[model samples]
Target: MRTFDTDALECLAAIVEEGGFERAAVRLSVTQSAVSQRLRALEAQVGTVLLVRSRPVKPTSAGRLLIKHAMQMRLLRADLETDLQDLTPGAGALREEDRISIAINADSIATWALPALGPLVSEGLPLEIITDDQDFTHEWLREGQVLGCVTTLKQALRGCKVMPLGAMHYVAVASPAYAAENCPKGLTTHNFRQIPFIAFNRKDDLQTEFVSRACGLRRVALIQRFVPSVEGQVRAVLSGWGASVLPTLQVQSRLDSGELVNLAPDVTLPVNLYWHCWNLDSVVIDRLTAALTTAATQALKVPG
Candidate 1:
């Protein structure tokens, strides 16, 4: 059977998380030389260099693979410890609570996911949330940087299971005044170059994709400022900053009250999202999955 030096593997994970050997040493409460010795011993035993030893240090493919293993082990170990504590009648709580790192999209974080996860977090299960675009969260999942992720990637990884969580529907919208003033001609291929819009970030092509698919305008002019947040994006629209595609959940009330105008009232964009997590026998993971599934049912559009 292949064996591992658990401590050394953990040391490597610390380096990856803390971003440097010095910080890792501080985190592990060990001397820098001791940390170096453990890493060297680990590399020697595996006959491979697990860390790049760069300024902040990076993991090679092999290193990433090992780091993945180490992280999974940590989650399992945390579960085991929790179960053991439960069996002991008078066991005190852990000195430091265990944490499960999860990846979710920025939109989901700002919208429904956090409110759903609030109860669990309030109960003391430390949650480390990594927010990215829904389409890209799978990369974090594949790297084992997170225990699970909410993503648009529907296929399961080799060692993970995928669960469809329905979709987050989006609508093209603008403030009633902005639509009247800028889009006096309304959204059209001819006016595509003239209307202003907001982009969350460079990678955020949510506005771009909406125009092409909904209006059949592939090339567009970005004549607006970047607002890199959900509330900010909505506020920008409300303050007549620009027209942008927003999640249906965010603007539904505004649409009803005339605070926002749905430019493409009949058009909607649905991003089908899924949950991906390690295929393992873990109560903690199972509980979290159940909670997320329940939340998604309430927050997301059900598949017909």
Candidate 2:
């Protein structure tokens, strides 16, 4: 049986999380030289190159395995802290490195994820959220960059648990004036190519997918404008920049107010989401899973 140094494991996590040796040192309250030494020592013990020396440090395959182990240990430690606090209130305080990090799609973060995590944060949970597209968020967890994630992937990764979180319904919408000017017939195939579509980012294919399905085409191309955030996309639509496929929950108020109109009332997209986390016996993970599932049940559309 082999035992590894906990300090070295945390140093590696800091380097990857903070993005560089200098930042990792700052995070760990150690000198850069010491940080490097710890990493080298750990590498010596593991007998391989653990990190790539890049602008933003990236972990090797072995390094990812180690980082996942470190995150699991941190979760167990947090659970232990909770137990100790119950026995003697205010006994242990977690350090900066002990923050619980997770990945969520940008749309969810803007809509319901933050509110679900708010109570825990208010009680000093030290939560960090990393946002990406729902289709790709699973990569964060697979790479061990985050302990948990809400993503569109249904299958559980090895050594992880998954739960369905319902689906987010999307509708094609635009400002009333824009719709009248660009899509008078309500987003027919003929007009879809003429009107610009507001995409969340280059990775976003929702607009293209929705338009293609609505038009009954194998594929269709549309003029596109990019807005990286959900709120930014909504604002761009409100400003009459372009048509967008937005969440019904996000645009319901604007639609009700007649500021935006659904371009395709009958065509809707429901993106199913799932919560994936390490299958660990930790109170923190349990609490997070509960909060997210409960909130999703109320906020997202039930899948039939």
Candidate 3:
């Protein structure tokens, strides 16, 4: 039997994680040709293709399986080191590069995600976070860019575990002045059709979805403003550019201060989020998951 070598698997994992041979080489501190040679050797040993070799190299099913094992090996190595250091009275503690990288939506990151991971970071464990739109974060998981993700999808990725994170409540809000001026009769789906909407970017559909659900309509007014960042989105709403669907956590202070008013108090947008990750037995990953689950339960309202 041809057993897979941990070093070769590590090289393949790095290549998939970095998305290219040159970048992977830089990360591994080796020449690009050396990285390529390692991958070729691994493929020959397994008698199967592992990477797609495209612009951003994608992993084949076989590659993903090995990458998952490689991540597990990293965690095992960390645990071994920690166990070895237990012999010393207090030998400075074990520091390892074993990380649980997560790709999560911007809204979740801006709201409850980081707080959920606070316990892990406080314990000195490494975590890597990649923020993108909720609709797109799954691609990172599929490509092996991250070991885990907080995604909007309910289904688990192949060879991965999925757990419900909870729903985030959003409300359409606008500056007091904007509401007073454009929203004479108070904010309603009927009047919302005419008012401009503020969005995070072209990918943002919060306003559109809200308007559609509220008015039994589809698209919102085309006269829209784009603010790419979470802070910028709030600022745009505050600057009277247009109304926006703001997360409760992000606008709680402003809402309490009377700076921003709810457009429709009865209408609420609840986005359900889920935690997805590789199914691996890793102490560090298990610890992080437990902490995240605890924090999320406290921070979010559990669905009935």
Q: Write the per-residue lDDT of candidate 3 for residues 1-304, one digit (tens) a residue.
A: 4578876887898887778988888887889999989999999988899999897988888888788767667767755655555565445433333555678888877877788788767655566788887877888888666778877899999988998877778888999899888996566666776788888888888878877777676665655788878888898888888888878878888989998998787787788878888787766667667866776787777754
Q: Give the TM-score of candidate 1.
A: 0.88
Residue 35 CA error for candidate 2 (Å)?
A: 1.2
Q: Compare the candidates by TM-score and give the number of the best one.
A: 2
Task: Please give the distance, in angstroms, between residue 229's alpha carbon in candidate 1 and its true position after superposition.
Answer: 2.3
Off by over 4 Å in 2: none
- Candidate 3: count of backbone clashes, pairs at least 3 residues apart or interchain: 0
Question: What is the per-residue lDDT of model 2 for residues 1-304, given as tens digits with 9 covering 90 to 100?
Answer: 6778999999999999999999999889999999999999999999999999988989999999899888887888888877887799888766668888899999999898899999988766878899999999999999987889999999999889999999999999999899888888898967888899999999899998899888899888889999999999999999999899989989999899999999999989899999999888889999999999999999997765
In model 3, the runs with Cα more than 4 Å from the true position are 81-97, 142-144, 155-159, 201-203, 218-226
For model 2, give the 10-residue run with minimal summed lDDT: 90-99
lDDT of 2 at 263: 95
Better-scoring candidate (TM-score), 1 or 2:
2
lDDT of 1 at 258: 90
User: Model 1, which residues run further than 4 Å from truth?
Assistant: 31-33, 54-56, 85-98, 217-225
lDDT of 1 by residue, 75-128 (tens): 876677567767974454422323578899888887788888888676556678
Question: Clashes in model 2: which pairs?
Answer: none
| TM-score of candidate 2 relative to the true fold | 0.97
**Which candidate wins on lDDT?**
2
